[model samples]
Structure formats: C-alpha cells, structure tokens
Target: MKADETIVNGVRIGGAETKVGEDIRTIELPSGARAEVRKGYGRDLMRAQRAAANGDASAVVFALIAEVTRVDGHKIVYEDVLEMDLADVMALQAEVIDENFDRPPQRASQASSNPDSQSEH
Candidate 1:
C-alpha cells in the first residue's frame, strides 16, 4: 500500500479528516496501523490560548507540542520538556480565528460611529 493509501475499518484514508473532538474515532491504515482522531487544531489552539491567558505555561507548551507533532507527523520526544514561543502561538491563533470567523472589511467611518443615536434636546 502507498503512504497516502490507507484503509481503516474497510474505509479508505487519504486526505485529512474533518470533525475532531473529545470523542476518539479509530482510523486503521491499509498497513494495519491505527490512528485515533482527537481534538482539532483550532480547538487545541483555543484551549492553549485559554490556558496561557489563565497563566498556565505548562498547558500552553504541551498543547503547542501536541499540535506541532500532529501536524508534522513527528514523534514527540522529551514531551515534558517541550517549549513554545508565545508570540508564535498567538500569531497562529489569530490566523486561525481570522480564517474561520472572517467578517467583510468595514468602512472606517461607519465602524467608528456608534449604532445608537441620541435625540437632540
């Protein structure tokens, strides 16, 4: 079987899968290797952001390492000693948020003006 061609429970695995969350889903490759789908990158990034905001450095680092490892398909070594740059994490979070929840660019004047109007006395 080719690297891209994988079979899981009689189903083929080629591209990335959608819908990842707390619930684990098994994916068996044609080579019989199994992988479980966990939380998505966006969700994991959000969780790390929350943890970092709450002053939990360890949580932030762990989340970052887990995210990078998952994306790079590299085995995580020295998991306990994993470190992450806060700026990089924040940038990635911003990118993900912008991509997922993008709003049309608003005119500057209209955006500055308040929606509520007051009656002149």
Candidate 2:
C-alpha cells in the first residue's frame, strides 16, 4: 500500500452513544498510530489567544493539552506526552476545540444559527 493510503483524517464519533460534553475525533498521526482524540466543551479561545499573545507557544500547548481527555480511548495524562509530541497534541487539541467551538459571527449566515436569536414568522 502507498504511504498515503494508510492515513485516515477527521474521523469523528456520532449519535447518542457519544458523551454529553466530550467530542471525539480520530486521526492517523505522522507516526502512523491511530489516536482517538477526545476534547471537551467550554474551551476559552480568548484565554488561549491571550496565552499565545504572551509569546509562549508552550503555554498554549500545555493549556490545550489539559482539554485532551484521552488517547486511543484510554485516559492520557499530560505527562504522557513527550516534548516532541507537543505538536501532535496541539493538532489534536485544535480538532477537539474545533469540534465544539462556536461558529464565528462572520461565519453565520442565518439567524437560526444562533440559538438565542428569535425568528419572526
């Protein structure tokens, strides 16, 4: 098989069997390992942006790492990630947050996209 054929990207869990606050995504890493990345709701994008503004990428990486609930469906602690693995974790973190983050104002085309907005008949 070609090298590209082994990789699968953006695999996600659907249906009621999924958990309430956590969103799961699966991807094949550069290392060729399949990881089931779990992320949660309520990630503060403002805070993350602030941390990045401080010019400390490591801070953003660590902060995002905390939101990762598991790897391969097993509980993975922050310590389990090696220094070289920070990039991988960051990518997965983005997936987790992206899966749950709200669509930005510019991205919304309909009032119905915003739950609090009332539509007139």
Candidate 3:
C-alpha cells in the first residue's frame, strides 16, 4: 500500500492524511489501538437512543459510540465494539461519553450573545 492510501474495513481510501480538528478527537486504548471520534450532533444521539430502545444506559452509550467513532479509520459498528476487549471498550466508552454527552449544557447567552446585554427599548 502507498503512504497516502489506507485500507479501512478492507476498502481502500486514498487521499491526504486526515488531521484531528476541533470536531474530531482521538482516543488511544491500552492495547495500542486508536479510535478517532467525531463530535456528534443531536440527531446522532437520537439515532443512538432509538437503536438502543428499551435497553439500559450502557446500551445507549455503546450505540452512541458506534454512531461517532472510527477505529483503524473504519466505522466501528456496535457489534464490533461488543466483540472488543472489555478494557478497550471501556476506554472508547469513556472518551465517547465525555466528548459527546458529559459536557455541561451551553447557556443561551453563551451561545448567542453576552448575558448582560440590554434589550433595545
């Protein structure tokens, strides 16, 4: 394989190397395997929740991981995560949950404008 080409899930993708950006982050497992996780949006969360319907919190989290993570540059589905070692899965879960769900909600003022701004009369 050439330096610019990568085989992800047995399919080759050739291009410039991808760098981690504000929207994407990397998680390294104890086994030296790495997962590239992207920040998921509300739709991704809703899809994950639906996929884990009636399942426990862990199931939902796993589904979310599947929704947002790529291992070896390949999308790792829920079943792939399930087949992983416990420690690796836990590492992925922690990173995925922290990146996607654990952050405090952004205040409306923080998102749009200053909280102390006065309204026009």
lDDT: worst 10-residue window of model 2: 6-15
After aligning candidate 1 to the native by TM-score, how far in Å is the CA of 31 from where it should be? 37
Give the candidates in order of TM-score, highest first.
3, 2, 1
Off by over 4 Å in 2: 1-22, 43-63, 82-87, 105-121
Most accurate candidate by TM-score: 3
The model with the greater lDDT, 1 or 2, is: 2
TM-score of predicted structure 1:
0.29
* Clash counts for all predictions: 1, 0, 0
> What's the alpha carbon RMSD for model 3?
9.2
Q: Compose the digit string of candidate 1's lDDT tens values, residues 1-118.
A: 6565555445333434444444443444333433333434565566455535665765565544344332224222213224434553344344434444468987757434755553
Scored against the true structure, residue 55 in model 3 reaches a CA lDDT of: 72
Backbone clashes counted, model 3: 0
Arrange candidates, best lDDT first: 3, 2, 1
Every candidate's lDDT: 0.43, 0.51, 0.74
C-alpha TM-scores of all predictions: 0.29, 0.43, 0.64
